[model samples]
Target: MSVEEEDCPPLLETCAGERGNEDDDSDGWDEMEVSGEQTTCLFCPLQFHTIAVALDHCRSDHNFDLLSLKAKYDMDCYSYIKMINYIRLQKPHPKILTESSVALWEDDVYLKPGDMETWLMYDFDDLGSAPSTPHYAIDGKAPISNLSFSDLQRQIQELTIQLKHKDMLLENCHKDMEHMRKVTKTIVDSGDSLNKKIPNNVISSGCDSSDYFNSYSHFGIHHDMLNDAVRTEGYRDAIYKNIKMFAGKIVLDVGCGTGILSMFSARAGAEKVIGVDQSEVLYKAMDIIRENNLQDKIHLIKGQLERVNLPEDKVDIIISEWMGYFLLFEGMLDSVIHARDTFLKPDGLILPNRCNISIVGVDDIDRYNKVVNFWDDVYGFSMKCMKSEVLREAFVEIVPPEKVITNSVILTEIDIRTCDVNACIFSSTFTLSAHKDGMLTAIAGYFDTFFDLETEVRFSTGPHATRTHWQQTLFYLPDTIVVKKGDRLEGTVSCTRLTKNVRGLSVTITIGKNKYHYSLD
Candidate 1:
């Protein structure tokens, strides 16, 4: 049977529960002048008298249901604009539209129109679950008084969404304050007991780890991590490339910021994936999961791994991006270890099961002068006293591989699946032989992670590899030492968690007769 006008109904009727006032149809519905234009099919070049006819042709002929696609992705007005522009520019096949990820239309460049799209003006609010301003209103061209009845409703809905977002932020702030108070009270109450447990040589001087978890409540830090391609892609490949390991497995993500890894696991055919986080960002992660339509396979809990109870008893795999500067400065591995012991099954595996921290001597006089000597004479005044404090802080920066003067030595190799929490705090002896005759002014540390899958997935945050957010942790010596080629510098490096802030590290380097102490906080 050939499709006709009566067979294909108006576009507004297809939008379930999103129609506006019925009386508006009689109140100058033709004011927009939508008639008399030939609308093109979204997937084909066929022309129709109206948009409803074109959309109906797309559904009947191409089997592309726009309403279902919009509902599935929960695209906002901007997204719809981008999608329309994308189709006009790309002219992708209907199969591509059905199988492609929503991220295909996420580029901001697609927000601009390739041509005038009058069809996008119809049933805008029905395209998204959330209330959002139309893209034109964002440009300040559309005002409330001049807006159509639907646009006016969208404007009010946008304000309601903004109010809800603000209220959520205020509630998160209150929760953060209460959490800080409880942490401070616990630290003060346990001061005497904690001091007795810490070593006598360990010194604590730096900001306390009181706001460690709360610091992730903002979007900037998560943005930095997500933008690091090496860091983000490494996790994605580790989970996606090894589909056999993740298929039908129940996975646990510790410190699952933004729930990216959990979503990856869910997409990799995992039966279930749970993400546990202590920061308020977990709320945002929950919304992101919903937006991506992965809320069914992935679940999130906003609490510490040790305190929270999982919906499932045992998980087949535990994955976490818990590494910090020099591999363990943030003390997140302790939580991962707790999750492993409490929740992981007997045969469960950890993503990036192996991590190796390496150190190399560098002869970067320019960096040494800028970081250390700059304080000696600040604006023609003697400010050398500040150099002591400066030298005690380990700097996170990128050291050119050409500046390296000695061979790299492995400081520690951590097997997350078997290593205990105490493994992170230990003394290791290493010998670095000078590869060239140059001054040794500082020691730089970097780490590499390995997934140990069928095809091992690994990335290095070393000077030679592409830079990650971790970069390299550099510890400057109090004074420089010159040596010839093949000269060996044997030293003992010890890491101890600070008494005041257990999440921070106090590293001590002891050479023959000299010693240097630095803090990684």
Candidate 2:
């Protein structure tokens, strides 16, 4: 440990004190009062007369040695203060501290002093004053140690109150966790013998927004979309057919995955095209734009629409292929809406300005048996217990037109040019009359986009239309319901955005007295 210390100098005083004089107060130790003041044990509720005795109790009772921890982490004065405060306020188990690779107190919130004020004690300072310890020296004296006793006491009181508010927030978060756990367990029954363990990431709170954006960084997702003729041609024709509107106009493409739409606009004689994305895919997109010789006409920016700047003051048109499965699954429309509100001119056109989400009943027993019943006998192992979880998530697949048993009903239509973010979460009731007598095993959803220009270019992902990358989203029922030729199924379908993961959707379909819930994540 002594050799390691010589190899690496300790962090300087400015580590936390850089904030202001408030941090300097951490070092104003009044040894006379500090040595006699009563303190609590770090890992337990026991009290000691002095910080030295309290540390000794921690080493013996909890196997937590402060000196050894300092040596292992190469901690400096600020780290020591942070560690003392963390253990006092968070009450974390000693094992968790031992597993850390670094001090793990780099977060400024941990620098705030807690009630213990353990840094004021001599035993804590002894570690910093040791000859073998590395510390920033100024004429053989540390600047913080010269602070007056009163300044330290006042600073501690202010810092302690600040930490109390943080503690309250943490308590509320714990309550929210408990509530979500109960709600999730109720949504999916816990008695399934095949599935007993529920990992923390399965909970919505465990999801990070970065994980959602990082998914688009991969090549396969782009490859699938680029290879889909129906999807690519829809955007291509929308720009080419409305050449009069796109010619000599500035266009902004939000959530531009591979800069395809930007290049399309450039090909349509746009004066300039700006494509913005917040994923690693933008690096490759830069190379793609240069390779196509469209670099002079297109500029690719890497950031969210709300934060990034566009070269033009206001664009004359905005082109984006932001549709997801079931029309609004990934919530990419929110980004497009933000771009519209921030960068587009008052009369700017949004390519594919209109979109329609429709629902149609499907009579595909083969798919139902393959997805759900296949679990009943997986190599003769009776895995029917896994069916409950399988039924909770919607599937994106193609259902043949012949299998559709009812006429399509338009659930909702979104005008991208005028819609806000809240419009994405919507509910609509529909009554689908069966055109032929058949067993309705699932409800399939598809969307159609309209350019609404002079040519009015439009494309559909419905079962009767040409297939696209977003084939169709299917929600299979637990049991097939029999229907006559003229029978109508009355129900309400609602799409809601999940609180924790904004990109994820929670869908509920109610048919008469039965309600089915599913997640699109």
Candidate 3:
């Protein structure tokens, strides 16, 4: 509370009269009506009731620095906050920023910067009071004080609407909490019995949780993913071209979404093919097999590969399209490994015998603009909160090759034929020499899969290749680093399987002093 008496020395009569009510209106001052004879400062002792006259006294006599007011608030958008303009016939308050928040308003509408240039009026009243803090923060909340009689009436109407919204959210959260409690109770009760939880103990022990995979069974997610030509065609190419391997062979399709690979093997002259999927979509696979009249050759198993019993003792070939983002994100590869070890014949072959993972430096100016920098001035307010949250999260999307600003480096290669599930987690150091001068913003990961050694049939989920269901994973840097065309950027990227949630993954990348952590959620 910085208050003073006679703080603004009186001005000369002629000078004050020249800068009167007309001047006040021109300087964007809207104040309470006062008589010409009522010349004393209405709010504080100074010279006149007109805001223009009082402002003149403060500016010339009192030394009220406008720049200091801005610096006090660390305000960049000065045009939106007119603290002095809102005060009626009084000098600028020293603690305006500490006492109140300033917002742009016009004709009862809140305005943001870069909006209409006119209608820059101000309102200082707000009492029909809801505590300026969240209404749910405490049991008793009061609205802030200082509103005109008319403004108070309008504010009360607004608070009523907000209170209803808060109540609805509280109710929904309570319901969800109750449901989770029941689920917890069921797990605790089962633990007391010490009995085996399921028929297949391996799957239960190996998987942290299968709830993430259960989502694929709903709606048309699995069906839509199956329709992606880049994914389905790769398996189609591998199975058909290896008909020599499939001829008179017993094949197994692990985690088969719709039995597409099984049908391909059956049509390729396989003696029999077993297709297993734990999703409800498996029911549709039965219909597909019947319509294709391949029931004689393809058998559909509707359970997890680890739990389900295979009709045949062993299979000559096992084919599965189990790759996820970054080649191992979904954790389905573990199930494939289990099926192979338990049921495959000693000479059995895996469809994708080899896979190569790759990483590259990216410019990605367009993506950064959309996801990060756009929040710098959302509707004129500093929506910096969104920018901070996005910086901490990983983005999974199809990245174009043109966005890569440097040469790619091979992170690691996997011979899925000989590679165990635990071997999927890996790390590599890369030296990315800049292809062109640009600000490197992020690092992206991609992988290429090989089907066979005979024909070398393979496809890439790389930026340089056609679109695939397994889109590239982008880890945005905490801060962009500028590089010359030939400058080399050295960094290490380590990817790990999160044992707590098998479907989840954590990737850490380091460049210079900046380190970033991202995850597939």
Candidate 4:
């Protein structure tokens, strides 16, 4: 028969042949077209026995009545059928389809037989064919049966919710970035901020005489004075003998400000000498090296000791002048620890092998009384009107150290020769109490070094001491108080290792010999 013949048999009959004849007798007895089955499709001229076939023909041939076709025939047909079959199959045993029943077959679209291999390789789902087994539920419920259109809808809804959440997170991140930018700009604009570059002249001038006398007088002689002292016969003989201990060995001078110690190492006949520092003082040292024609023996690196890139276990000796004012004020000893761990050989020596810091009670009663009386006069005023004025004048005055009560504690004893600079963390606890009624002046502190077995260095409280410009700095307290004899004060000192040479130390002080106490934090 021709493809367009109206007398063509049904698809089942054409495919199954004679075995499909069982249902033929029910609709037989006439060769004429049934009048009620002559529905015409509006999209095309095709006529059919059912609206479904007519609609399908119209869509395929003329692209017509799309809304009607979708409404009637495209309502997740496979999903619905699979759901029905899933329900029936749950009963178990030889499955059979009744005349009035329906069946659904839903399976993982990607894991079906033909697509399984492809899914394994690419992790992608194939949408080319209907599934043969049920994998999801129909309606909005769990699969007592199998796959359903409602489940697909739910998946789509969940994906939409996730996308919305991601968008909200992105918006918040943008707001944070804007806030950070504003804060950074404000910090940059602040004129006195330390992050801003310091003037070269200011850094080069070293510490002034006032700073020296106010803070460092008790500690030790300056570097220049020490150099002069070393030039004398007695000092020279002692220093020479010390240098002879490390002769013809590799040596490192850390925080080598002017490369003086490195030069000493070179003069001592060390096979090689390397000096490192962050200050521009290396330039002056370079000139000195050339002038003395010692350039061939020494090498200098311009950087922080912690960041100096050198091979591990490469040096025979590690030397440094890292002590800060108040012994632990700037926490530069942390850097010395790093150099010791990374560059020194296991058995190498450290110059000034150890340092001892001690605390003692002293008398300075007159100085403490003056500062307390001054603050009392100011507090007597109506603070509401003079708050700003009081604040502006607070830092201008200086008080004597002895008036302030002190219960000192030893922070730590460092053996540079054996201490692992990388792992050391310094911490301590202290309590300060007034022994007598007085005005607080300043805290007197100092450090002593054991350079080797017999030779030693000490900074003492005296005049005409050799002074290198790096005098100790005073951490002036914000306010001074008056205390009578036998008042007790107590607090703790906390220190954290920050970097190679830097440490952060914080002291908390509580006042009053009895129940009265205040904290700095």
Q: Which candidate is the best by lDDT?
A: 1
Best by TM-score: 2
> How would you order the candidates by TM-score, starting with the best?
2, 1, 3, 4
Question: Per-residue CA lDDT of candidate 1, range 177-225, in tens?
Answer: 7877996778778868756453221122222224888899989999999
- Candidate 3 Cα outliers beyond 4 Å, as residue runs: 1-209
lDDT of 4: 0.46
Tens digits of per-residue lDDT, candidate 2, 1-521, equal: 33543553233222232323533554322221212235667778787655556667888999888888988978776777767765554455686577543343434456654554434433344563434322222122233453344655666677779888899989977887887799687757757735755321111223223776799999999999999998898789888887888889998888888999999899999998888888778878887987999888888877667765567789999888889999999858988888888888999898879999999999988889999899988887999889989998899999999999998999889999888776555667889999999999999999998989888788999999988989999999887899999999998887756544667777778898787888898
Instruction: Tell me the TM-score of each prediction against the true structure.
Output: 0.60, 0.61, 0.59, 0.44
Q: List the residue pairs that clash in candidate 1.
A: none
Q: Whole-model lDDT for model 3 versus the true structure?
A: 0.65
For each candidate in the order shown, give its overall lDDT on alpha carbons.
0.77, 0.76, 0.65, 0.46
lDDT of 3 by residue, 21-111 (tens): 5434343122222113323332356545333344356555545433444454453433323333332211223332233222211111112
For model 2 the TM-score comes to 0.61
lDDT of 1 at 145: 38
Candidate with the larger TM-score of 1 and 4: 1
Q: Of the pair 1 and 3, which is ahead by lDDT?
A: 1
Can you give the lDDT of residue 426 in candidate 1? 62
**What's the residue-level lDDT of 126 in candidate 1?**
49
